[model samples]
Target: MTALPQERRIVTAIPGPKSQELQARRTAAVAQGVGSVLPVFTARAGGGIIEDVDGNRLIDFGSGIAVTSVGASAEAVVRRAAAQLADFTHTCFMVTPYEGYVEVAEALAELTPGDHAKKSALFNSGAEAVENAVKVARAHTKRQAVVVFDHGYHGRTNLTMALTSKNMPYKHGFGPFAPEVYRVPVAYGYRWPTGPQNAGPEAAAQAIDQITKQVGPDNVAAIIIEPLLGEGGFIEPAKGFLPAIRDFAAANGIVFVADEIQSGFCRTGQWFACEDEGIVPDLITTAKGIAGGLPLAAVTGRAEIMDAAHAGGLGGTYGGNPVACAGALGAIETMRDLDLNARAKAIEVTMKARLTAMAEKFEVIGDVRGRGAMIAIELVKDRTTKEPAPEATAALAKACHQEGLLVLTCGTYGNVLRFLPPLVIGEDLLNEGLDIIEQAFARI
Candidate 1:
């Protein structure tokens, strides 16, 4: 049944004639605001390869931005989704409740970082889940203000745009954002003002201090953060930072939320990245890898807090669509049956080993950090100055593309090359992708 071959083969240029023709049509049809990493249109994808319309198969290094962690067309995911489609695609959970939605809620309760009583509300996207998490937190605590960290990416909705730190791309002209969202610094070790050693404790202390003085902790509903940063770069807060902030939130009676949209579902060698720091959030927003390649998201949280939202307030017209729920159930089974967590850890070991060696030879690599399959290297112009090298990063990505490898570049400074390979990706394919990266860096 497997039709797509998992090998890198270039029949033409990176974006061949067919892809270029499609790109021209796309430019006219699709909105310019909606961006894409590569212009090559995918015709088929499986395992570690994405086959473009021009018959070029490129090794995947970015798992659709951590959405397809299992794989592009995972058997379980496709089977369940297809089966569900045969019966029904959408009846709307709000209009007619289904068992699949409840099943997914039960799975989330069992899998997310806490043994404590938990509840979940499904949504259509990571942004919706985040917005709802904040809604529930505000409802529970009766507070309006929310605290967020710098270099943290929550979502693109109005509220999330306010919470996000990057201004140019995500929040350029769209302003007059939702009020009461405050920003604090994160323990970004590489770019920390002071240094890496003191980044953890110092950042936590400063965050708490700022909240108390500037925002007034008693009036704050939640302090939200990403256990592992995504679009703002795959920066993991320095050690002890998350726990410290978690304790502060607990002491102040403010809900703590972990935006695990990009880092959860076995992406970080664990079910959730919050587990990495042993921090159990009051509410955790999840999506991306939750439903394999399908669209589904949820806000899993403490029972009392989640239940505080009114019965009628949380339901959405298409949230937790039955087909998507089925896909999520299948994705969960795939994650467990194949032991993707251990595979992710293995990927971390391999990627870190290769990336660290590359850092030694290439001065452009200023820092290499991340856990499990979510690894990245910060690009810099000068080793001593640590100036961001966005230009070099772009050139390196283009070079890799030409050599039949799909890569992604990110970071607030646009100078980090992130890797999020599918858990089912073959080790041989992984190394081949890395080889392409090494050669590209050499040429760049």
Candidate 2:
């Protein structure tokens, strides 16, 4: 049965009473460095709603940037984590291996798309998983050059920053990035090098040509990409792009790596977005929703590639924390039982239908595209020109949040409104949120 949202109880202003006080205190105490996305502080979250510090419940559409797929405060996840907590905490998988760690690894090796014998290495964050994948690729291929696609986000670390294409937010101050990292253009259909009509395998072929000419394929170790480019405006590569890239990597002896941090764990209506294209990468890096809300990441790949890393070269002090490992075990089990892949597809269907209708109603909405639960709507000034409407997107997001529906914005130009609702979200709530989006756009 689909559940309707209770109400939109603003209580006070946008920040409310308690949030303002906390914000001032936070400004005084915490590093004035990082900032908050939403001003209202979260006191509790359940199902698809976030209860703020002032007791106002807001419908959640971000899903913690696609990390909490099963929904916040999930009963099954809480129970499993509590049970594991009672037993013990840490043993350091490097020094003394635990059954839970191995169990999680086994689950990953089995669940990750591929029929081949695979191995998994655990880490604590998406960045770590990406870094380790690079190490493994270098070790296996005995090459130093690694190629990454434009608009792909790996992580914030030095190596990842170099691998990442964004500049202002991620790699602004951090200079002198890691060496031997290369970047190529991704097949962005909306505004491709050649017009959208010609943005198919031909765009990818041009990129491959540039790499072969400039970088020289003989020196490349690996080519990394997100199956569905996440931070790069949720752009889905053209039909033939992925397959062509895969074939090129295989033919050139360059290990193909899939950065599934954002698109993994059924976020794309499949275990990994790569599965949709039937391209099994040599290495797949995952994190985000892998361990429910806990911090955990992994690199699962061909046994030969994974085994190339030296025994001690791939571990962190708290790499596979026991609690996190237990969380991952429970999360994977929950995904299997709940059939989250199907749920993602269901969410995609709901979103595509309503958003497409909304697009027809609004000229600001230029494009609507995504794989599954991971979806985004690109805002533009005009349908003919496709000029990004960043201000309009900001206005729409602000209006939705004021109306008690939380949505996130992304893109190089900041004109895209992305929806990453929990797969377990109720249909009524989802529709209600879509209604709010419609109302916001109507006001525009």
Candidate 3:
């Protein structure tokens, strides 16, 4: 496939005529439950830009929701996947395994945090990896209850929905969810009632106290958390908060799991966000940017814990598909060759400088936080009151869209604007996207 121009160009309106037609067809054929952030139909996407069917090129700040860190069509990933497809599609790893599957597992075992003897089980999505992690924890500990934090988003599956905190879009009316799942307080510095300075230790103490009093530490199977909360407004847990929780889990014999699906893969300047805190989890679940754009996820952890499951107790028919495995190998190679971790750090510096400056001018930007490329701005009515400004957030996003920039809004209250540009995106494109954002804020 030939490369589309890297520059953003608007030949027509935001959705354009062709995209509007496609939107009409999509409405008729697609399920109402599914959602798309933008109505434009993509003809090609790579580097920093997505070209819609109407020939409008828009700077991509979403990166398919952090799944395309190496760019949506990285050359290495495309070549490897194409070669694998030409060779053979699938033979079912469970029935007749392939070397690609084993290789990908080996890569994960080496890359994931902790130097202990680790093993991995590959799956098709982040939710599957999380579900299997829970199963492994339960099997190993022979315990019942699992603990999660406020504003954490695991996935949309039955068990994960129970684990997730948000109710409207993710869990509303979908419940009567899985049992034995408990909720705890996260050390969200911005929203902590006590104040940012005391958020870490106080929240940690409260969570540990609640867990011991309500769930009983001995009965808890696992404690799962995102080192940096993703769907929960990109809230970075206050310093020392994660280590405190890690220590508690260790003392209680509860398995500690890090749901790094969105925060992993060099997006946080480290291989995994948990590394920043030096908190090594027993099991780390990953997916999003694992295989360029193909569907693949893994549960990597201590050998004893991963091996706890009986011979046939784990795996799915399509888990670790060969094509996806090939894509993963290529993606890992690209990350290493390009040193995407450093790139992410550099991007963080650029973003922090710009967003920080913007915060100085715009009081509506109540807070600016996040590490590396996974950054966000929380919108509020007033700096002092800090009342969430969800409508303003939506308007800003729409403004960015109309000006040929694809931005995404997230957060429990839908009052955050997140930027997840591909690590491979050029500096020029990054600055251009930020300029559009500043312009959007001015217009809104």
Q: Candidate 1 — number of clashing residue pairs?
A: 0
Model 3 CA lDDT for position 283: 98
Tens-digit lDDT track for model 1 on 393-415?
99999999899898999899999
* Positional deviation of residue 402's Cα in model 3 after best superposition, in angstroms: 0.7
TM-score of 3: 0.99
Candidate 3, run of 10 with poorest lDDT: 1-10
lDDT of 1 at 307: 95
Residue 428 displacement (Å), model 3: 0.4
By how many angstroms RMSD does model 2 differ from the true structure?
1.8
Q: Which stretches of model 3 miss by more than 4 angstroms?
A: none
For model 1, the superposed segments whose C-alpha errors exceed 4 Å read none
Tens digit of lDDT per residue, candidate 3, span 1-444?
A: 217678999999999999999999999999999999999999999998899999999999999999999998998999999999999999999999999999998999899989999999999999999999999999999998999999999999999999999998999998799999999999999999989999999999999999999999999999999999999899999998999999999998899999999999999999999999899999999999999999999999999999999998999998999999999998899999999999999999999999999999898999999999999999999988889999999999999999999999999999999999999999999999999999888877
Each prediction's Cα RMSD?
0.9, 1.8, 1.0
For every model shown, the clashing-pair count is 0, 0, 0
lDDT tens per residue, model 2, 1-444: 123244455676777889889988898899865766678998887667877999888888998989989776666667777887888777788899888889988888888888898999999999999999999999998989999887888899999999999896889988999999988888899888567777767778887998899899989998999989888789898878988999999999999999999999999999999998798999999999988898899999999889998889889888888888888877787788889999999999999999999989888889999988999999999888889998998999999988888999888888999999988888888899999999999997
At residue 17, give the lDDT of candidate 3: 99
Model 1 steric clash pairs: none
